[model samples]
Target: MSSKARHSLDPLNLDRFNHEALIPLVSPLTGKNYIGWCNHIELLLTATVKLDFITGKCERPTERAKAEQWDLVDSMVRSLILGSVSKEIAQHFIHAKTAKSLWEEIKGRYGSHGPLLYRIHRKLRSIRQGNADLFEYYSKLCNLWSELHYLKPIPVCKCKCNVGKEISVGECNGCILAKQIADDKSETELFQFLMGLNDCYDNVRDLILLMEPLPTPSKAYSMLLGVETMRELSKGEKGCEKTHDLVCSYCKKIGHTHEGCFKLHPKTKRSM
Candidate 1:
């Protein structure tokens, strides 16, 4: 009678299911990785169309034949749950006959940590670039942002909203205000990223913020990357020019000076 009822009747789904090859190497649920494991396993279940099993959205049928098929599908999803977590966690939930029960039990045991949320927020606020390169620093911020977002999902209404659709920049005239609001939300991250950047990039950071329309975080990254590349190229060219001016009075070599002539002092060199 339901979508799962029809979907469970298909033996091809079970026959084609390959758990070993499909399981990602995510952290175990027993560790401090409930978020990562939860997100990863949900994606796998969603892709396989078995998400309903754990979500408890589908009811069991009254007919024995249909109920048996439902149990078979539930068993498959249960196996997926067991395989993802640590052996201890798997053993603890061994008696949870249904996938939904197992999933809820696991969530109850580990998902509601108040300290983790606070810790993540503190880490985000205190994050600094330090000695890490731009790419590395940006990647760290992105990873934290992703986890933070997962914990507190952004609320956006897509119903009859043009901004929710794939309408290009100017084409989104109707939802211009909506789009601007969404864009404004991301400015927090952009400002945070810019603040964490090395002070040497103060000029470029100011230049980026001065743009009329304002740039997205990624656009800012590219602009700063261009400036960084130019600075590196300039330094390299200066180093090359200084190297080219070297000349040895002893060996008459362009690369070595008289005091640093290898021929004059075989074991030790000097530069004039």
Candidate 2:
């Protein structure tokens, strides 16, 4: 063989060889000799081509040929970081045409206050392929954070233990305690509990006001009386003085003090 042919025949030169020349060069070596040294070379080349395609570096596929590989890389990174629990979520990342679009979706979905979203963006920007698993874990956390953000707090009664009066929309200590006890319940169950309490309170408030002296009942006793009795009480009010510290003067809700009210119109159409 000539020097060029000898050099081409060398296994170490595989990296420098072009795809067109690789098949022909390997045609001579066969049996154990080729199998031991260059059997995996074809497979390796195939994998490299696939990776290039996935990363948008492939020369073929004319429509997507002009697309930037970095954009695809960014989308991959974002997808892994922002955990896709379903095929739909995974498709979002896979179909994204640019890093900017993917980033915009993330911001629109998760960014309300600037700080939290910015912090997440910064963290994602710092991660690379070497730490891919960490990136994936962070993505799941982001999804969880987004889910928790929209989660409504469990509604509680709006009556003061001392006043023994119920309002149309109120949150009291008993309501808060009940919510805590129902913490393990599903969101649907929690919602039902809140709606049931609201309806029951409205019914009892009208009946109790018609009676002479307002009836007084302990928080625990009132809760145990069930929705029906609480709805029909002619003259009784429950007190939640035990959770005085948890009461919010602004929204009149328990489990959060006035300072902790998250409502935009906390007391009088003013941001809290």
Candidate 3:
């Protein structure tokens, strides 16, 4: 095989996989954040095609040679599990015989479902846009939604029958799609987003709702940004103007951007 072909075949060359680089941990996993940490590790392993080693889908071969290879792969996965966690936590599971055992030990200790899931739901409900910017509030809510989805993913519909014609309409609506799919009003992200905003946004909220199909939370946010800008201008709160931050591509100087540079727009400059 050519060198390039050989390289392609060995994509999962164990030495090439850097645990920290692949996992992107802000800090080593602490017991409190086991869910988020496990999510990251799962993605990394699945991408590398080594998930089965840790998931117990790949069993050890009875043949001596194959069993030895299996042990080597299991050790690598076990090392990855250890490297991902804090040193203190790693001590407890370092002696596990298989990667799956280590993973289960961590999950069994910290992955208590009933109480943790309840807290996640409660926290999701408690979030609001009060006293925060629209973008900031949206980010917080979406992040929690993301983490929740990862922990308990909704089942994928793998129907062989294609619905033929696309059924897309005003997905921008305040969760018409949610009502149809989930058949629950509370499951609507759009509804949750709109209802969370402060009373100061009541007029804009009404305008958003009056539309035939309500604007998406994102579209509503953009509209609200316009309103926020108008409100700021009305209060004489002019936003920061980074005039010096701009650089002219033509003249290579501060004070004007490439589009506004006098050299680039000579005719307009002359007219001015």
Per-residue lDDT tens digits of candidate 1, residues 1-272? 89777766553256546665555555667757788789998888777677778888766778998888888878878887888889977888899979999999998888875766887779889999888888899998887778777887654444464454553234345456555656775788899899998776665676678776788888888877665664455455421222333445575433344565679887784433
The residue-by-residue lDDT of candidate 2 on 1-272, one tens digit each, is 89987755433233342444443333332221222212233343443332332233433324553334434434443343233223444354555554345434543554444554455445444433232332343344344334333342344455554244322232556655654544433332222222323232333334433434333322222332443332234224342222233434676543445555677344643532
Q: On lDDT, who's better, 1 or 3? A: 1
Cα-based lDDT for every prediction: 0.72, 0.38, 0.67
Q: Pick the winner on lDDT between candidates 1 and 2.
A: 1
The numbered model that scores best in TM-score is 1
| Number of colliding residue pairs in each model | 5, 5, 0
Ranking by TM-score, best first? 1, 3, 2
Instruction: Show the lowest summed lDDT stretch of 10 residues, model 2.
Output: 29-38
lDDT, model 2, position 221: 22
lDDT of 1: 0.72
RMSD of each: 11.4, 25.8, 10.2
Candidate 2 residue runs with Cα over 4 Å from true position: 1-76, 81-85, 97-100, 106-272
Off by over 4 Å in 3: 1-16, 20-26, 162-179, 182-187, 229-272
Model 3: colliding residue pairs: none
Residue pairs with clashing backbones, model 2: 81-139, 82-139, 158-170, 161-239, 215-235
